[model samples]
Structures are given as structure tokens and as C-alpha cells.
Target: MMTVVHHRTVDVGGQAVFYREAGDATAPAVVLLHGAPASSFMFRGLIPLLADRYHVVAPDLLGFGYSAMPPVERFDYTFGALTDAVEGFLDTIGIRRCALYVQDYGAPVGWRLALRDATRITAVVSQNGNAYTEGFVDSFWKPLWDYAEDMTEEKAAPLRGALSLEGIRWQYTHGVPDTSLVSPDTWMHDHMLVSRPGSMDVQLKLFSEYPTNVALYPQVQEYFRTTQVPLLAVWGRNDEIFGPDGARAFRRDLPDAEVHLLDGGHFLLESELPAVTALMRDFLGRALPV
Candidate 1:
């Protein structure tokens, strides 16, 4: 039987938070959090595959996808604020405990959720979701690093290019050995949302506060070491934004963490969906039993 994924929205602190949900309401939950420039849409393929065994939920974070985008002037665009919104979303949606499938920008948000309430997280599945300094690919991050060092319009101007169609397309195709495997729709959808009016500023505001995430790495690692929560890292070995080292670094804190490196890019699901899906199924089956 084909699992039906539902498109829905809920009021999270007065904001209309959009999400995709599937599987049984009574089943164990798996929340998928997306990266920058993308949304719950990225999990379109993985949701149904997991829905057979687990209740899968993927939310479009505020300022991304169909979620309400409060103006940067009114909203604090830091990871902390994003986490609070996600926490509130989970509460409003009645998800008390679940595994977290985090990628890119979702890593910080997921980690914050864990920090705020470790008891609510059953396991973690990180796909190119970096948390350690070792994960950084200096070349790709230098520009952002420069901007973070000096928060000025001049410094932030160059970063806007990443919001362009070409730049967004490159993120999807960059490390994939076979570009044909990637669907054009992925980048197109992302570019559409990211290029929306005022979206660039929202992203920039989040970018400017990225340093805070890096600073919280120590605390996150401590949580890992202490909690010893089940963790699986399926990384795109060729990801230029976050190298495989970041995936391996998890072992430093949680030696039992499972790490797998596949040939792909930052957007591993775009090129290696099958492999990623299989790994998640196996990991979650054991880590978060139904």
C-alpha cells in the first residue's frame, strides 16, 4: 500500500508553519528538518519510504518554503529563534518524542531542540548536517566567514550571489558525479523561494548569526557525550560545504555513532536518495523501534 503524505499547516506562535506528514499518527515519529535554501520539500522522496514504519514529519522552517516569513525587522533570525519556533511547532503538532533527520541548516536547529529538551529526542539522523569545526570546507566558507567577522552591508553584498539561480543550482549539482541524477526541480523550487522578496535579508540575518552555532559546538558535543543518544551520519563524501570529516567527528563525542560516506554532494538526497533512505530505515529500526 502507498503511504499518503499530508500537506498541512499549524499555528506556531501565531505564524503559519507549513509541514508534510505521513504514516500512522500512533507510530514512532521522525521529524525531517531541511537546510538553507530548501524546505520540507527536500524530504518528498524519503517521507513515504519511511512512513511505512515510522510517522514522518517535515516542516518548512519559518522564512522558507510555504511557512510564514516574518520580516527580519520583527523576527530574530538566529538559530536559537529558529529552534524555538521548531520546538513550538512540534508542541502544537503533538509530537512529544521522535527521531530527528537533520541536514545543513537543520543541524543547528535540531541540536538546539535536543539541548532544550533532550528527553524529547529519541535518535538523530544527520545527512550532511555538520556540527564540528572539522566539518568546515574553508574555501567555500571563507566568504561567509569574512562576512561574519565584519557585519556590514559591504561584507554581506557578495553573499547575495548564493541566493541566485546559478548559485543555487551549483549547490545541488556541485559534487554529484552524475549531474543527470539530480532533478532540476530541486534547484528551481529552492531558487523560487529564496529569491522571493526580502528572503535574501532573512537568509543574510541567519548567516550573520551562524558564528553562534559554531560557538555552541562544545555544548552540543557535551550533550552527545553525556546522552550517548543513537546517532547516524550519512554524509556526501564529496560535499564541499561540509567535508566528510565533520561526519566522522561525531565519533569523538559518541564513539558508537554510525557514520557512512557516500559519493555525492551537500544535497546527498538529490543524488543518493535510495542509499540514504535504506540507511535511515535500518538505523531508525534499531535506534527508534516501533
Candidate 2:
């Protein structure tokens, strides 16, 4: 039987937030937060798979996918602001507690939620969602790091290429042993939305503020140690942006943290969906039982 997935939108702080929902609302809630250059659309495959056992909700962050893209002037594009929107969205929708599946940009947002109210997060499943200083690949982040130190058009100019169609394509294909597994639709869809007027600026603003997430690594690790929230790190071992070190680092804080390094790249779902889904089902079953 096919699990029915619903596409819906709701108002969160006057902004139209779009989300994909599945399974019964009464089931244990599992919230999926997508990374950069992707939206709830990234989880299209995973949602249905998890819906059979868990109530799954994947939302497009304010500036990504079908969600409202308020200009930088009106909305601060920092991760903190994004986290606020997600927090409010959860409150408005009555998801008091949920297991968070975070990736890339979603890490900061999800971690921030955990920081705000430790009781709200039932478990954490980080898929290339980094929260450690050692997780970053210097070669990949050097340019962005420079831009962070000196916020200027010149510094930001070179980084804009990353949001280009070609760059987005590379993001999806890179580190994957078999590029054929990555669908063109993934990058094309991302490029279309990212190329929108002022979208680049919005992305850059978030990029510049990424260091803030790095700064909070200690606090996040502390939460991991003290609260000892259920944690599972299912990472793409070949991801260059956030290497395997980040995944293994989780064990430093939570010695019992379950870590699985898969033979895939950044967008593991594209190449290893079944494997990832199976791991998640097992982990969530143990952490947040139905």
C-alpha cells in the first residue's frame, strides 16, 4: 500500500511556510529539515518510506523551495532567524516534541531547537549535518571562511559561483561513486529556485552567518553530553564539504552515539536511499518508538 503524502502550507509568523506531511498525526512525530540548495522536496522519497511507521513532516525553510522568500531587508537570513521560524512553525502546528533528521544547513536550525528546549527534541539523526569545528574541509571552506572574516562584495563575489547551475549540479554529483544515481532534476530544481531574483543575496547572507553555527559547536556538544539525547549519525563518508570526521566526532560527546558511514556522497539519499532509510527506521524505532 502506498503511503499518502500531503503537500500543504501554513502561516508561520505571517510567512507562508510550505511542508510535506505523511502518516497519522497521532504517530510519533519525526521532523525532517533539509540542507542548503534543497527543500522539503529533497525528502520526497524518504517521507513516504517513514510515513508507514512515523508521522513525518518536512518543511521548506523560509527562503527555500515553496516557502515564502522575504527579502534580506525584511528578513534576517541568519540561521538563528531560520531556527526561529521553524520553532514557531512547530508551535503553531502542535508538534511539541519530535525526532529531528537534519542535514547541512538544517543542522544549525535543528541544533538550535535542541539548545532552546532540550525536552522538545526526542532524538537527533544527523545526515552530514555538522556541528564540530573539525568537521569542515579547509579546502572547501577556505573561501567562505575568508568571506566571513571580510564581509565585502569582492569576497562575496567569488562565492556566488557556488549558487550557479553548474555548481549546484556538482554538489549533487560530487563524492558519489556512481554519478548516474544522482538525478538531474535535483540540481535543476535547486538552480531554478536559487536563481530567483535576490535569492543569491539571501543565500550569501546565510553563508556569511555560517560561522555563527561553528561558534555554537561547544554548546551543542555540551547539550549532547549533559542531556544525552538519543543521537544517530548516518553520514555520507565521502562528503567533502563535511568529511567523515564530523560524523565520528559525535561519539566524543555521546560515546554511545550510533555512527554509520555509508558509501555515498553529500546527498546520500540520491545514491543510498534504501540503505539510509533502513538505518533511520531502525534508529528511530529504538530512540522514538511508535
Candidate 3:
């Protein structure tokens, strides 16, 4: 049967969680978690590619994408809360087990799920997801560290630019050699979604608490050791935020993991979609076959 994506939302508890799904329900599931300043929208091109075989599900985290963006006072925007909502969403959607593909902010969200219940996961695809301290590079980490130290609007505003057009543009262009390969709409669309009411605050909340995720890295690594989970790390070598070191760090625990450093920036699918899809398909076939 031909594969097609369906943009849908499910009520998890009282909040609205929007997601994209495709493929037959009984097929093996693949959960794609996007990074900060991005929602399931990032998976648009890749969803149809994988949906032909596996059940692909990409959901917008709370306060992201088409999901309901409640005020900070209304919904605490922490990693814990985000995971709670995601796990609940999984239950509500009736997804019992699946492979996880996590990137940037999706790293922490996806790792939390793996740590919470290892049995629910079939395999892991780490795309620029950092699970080790060695992965923390200067260019991206320093500024955020400084911003987290001082919460003043002066510091916060520039940091907030990450949620703005210029920052989004920077993320897509900086590390890429062929600038033309990156699309302007990548940032433009994200800029529109993030500009929604109280959206920046939600991202800021996550920025402020990034250390918490870092603090739990040891545990995330431990879960890998105990579960011996199969892993496939496909990283965009040019990613300024998550340097190549972060991508290679997975081998520390899962030495048998398949790792690939692609020729692109933070958002690989933006420039190297076809290559990534090929690698992911091959990896899941060998490492996570149903």
C-alpha cells in the first residue's frame, strides 16, 4: 500500500498534543522527536520516506509546533513535565514499543523515555543527541551557559533570538559549506511557530534547565549499559551546537553502535535528507528489524 502522512492530535490528559503518523498500525513503530525551536514540522520530508515500512510518529512537544502552547504559569515547562506528557501521549496513542530517533532537545526528551522504561524501546537513533559531557562544545554551550547564569532581559533577549528568524537562520547556515543547500523556509516556518504567545518563555524554561538533563547523562548512559540497547548514531558533523564529539560519545557505552558523521549542519535533513533516510533505513533494517 502507498504510504501517506496524517497530521493528527490526541488529547493526553487535558493538553493537546499534535503528531504526524503514517503506515499500518500493526507495523513496527518509529518515534521521531524534534529539537528545540523546531516541532514535528522538521520531520515533514522524512516522515513519508519511512512511513512506507514502519509506523512513523512525530509529535510536537508541549508549547511547540501545532500543539497547545499554554502559559508558563499554566504549564511547567521542564524536562520532567515534557517527558510526563510524552509518556502519557504514548499510552494514549497505544504505542507500546518503538525505535526512537532523537535530535538536539529531542535528545533529553527521548533519553528520559528510554531511562524510564527500557523495555518499551526497540532501538535508538541518536542524531546529534548528546549523552556525554565531552560532547559539550564551546561555541554553542558558552553563550547558553552565560545566559543561564543571568536571567536579565539583557542576557535573555539575545538568547531568545534562538527562537527568532536570525537565530534560526544562523542555525541552518553557519556550519554548512554550501549555503544554498539550506532552505530559508526552515527558519522562517520555525520563526512563525515560536513567535506564538508565551512560546519563547517555554524554550527559555528549557534553556534554563538544560543543566538538569546534563546532570542525568550518567543515568542515561547507565541505562544503555544495563539494557545493551542497539543504537545508530547519525550526526551532522557540521553541527555547531552538538559537535561531532557528541555524536561519537555513544560508543562509550554501546561500543557496538553504528555511527555516521554526515556532511551537513545541525539540521541534516535540511541539506542531506536523502542520505540520512538511506542510512536510517539501512541501520534500522540491520539493527532494529521487526
State the lDDT of candidate 2 residue by residue for 23-129, as single tens digits: 98999999999999999999999999999888899999999999999999999898889999999999988999999999999999999999999999999999999
Q: Name the 10 consecutive residues with the lowest summed lDDT in model 2.
A: 155-164
For each of the candidates, give the backbone clash count: 0, 0, 0
Judged by lDDT against the true structure, how good is candidate 3? Answer: 0.87
Compose the digit string of candidate 3's lDDT tens values, residues 22-52. 9878889999999988889899999999987
Please, what is the whole-model Cα lDDT of each candidate in the order they appear?
A: 0.93, 0.93, 0.87
In model 1, which runs have C-alpha deviations exceeding 4 angstroms?
none
lDDT of 1 by residue, 3-75 (tens): 8999999999989999999999899999999998999999999999999989899999999999999999988
By lDDT rank, best first, the candidates go 1, 2, 3
Error of 1 at 131 (Å): 1.1
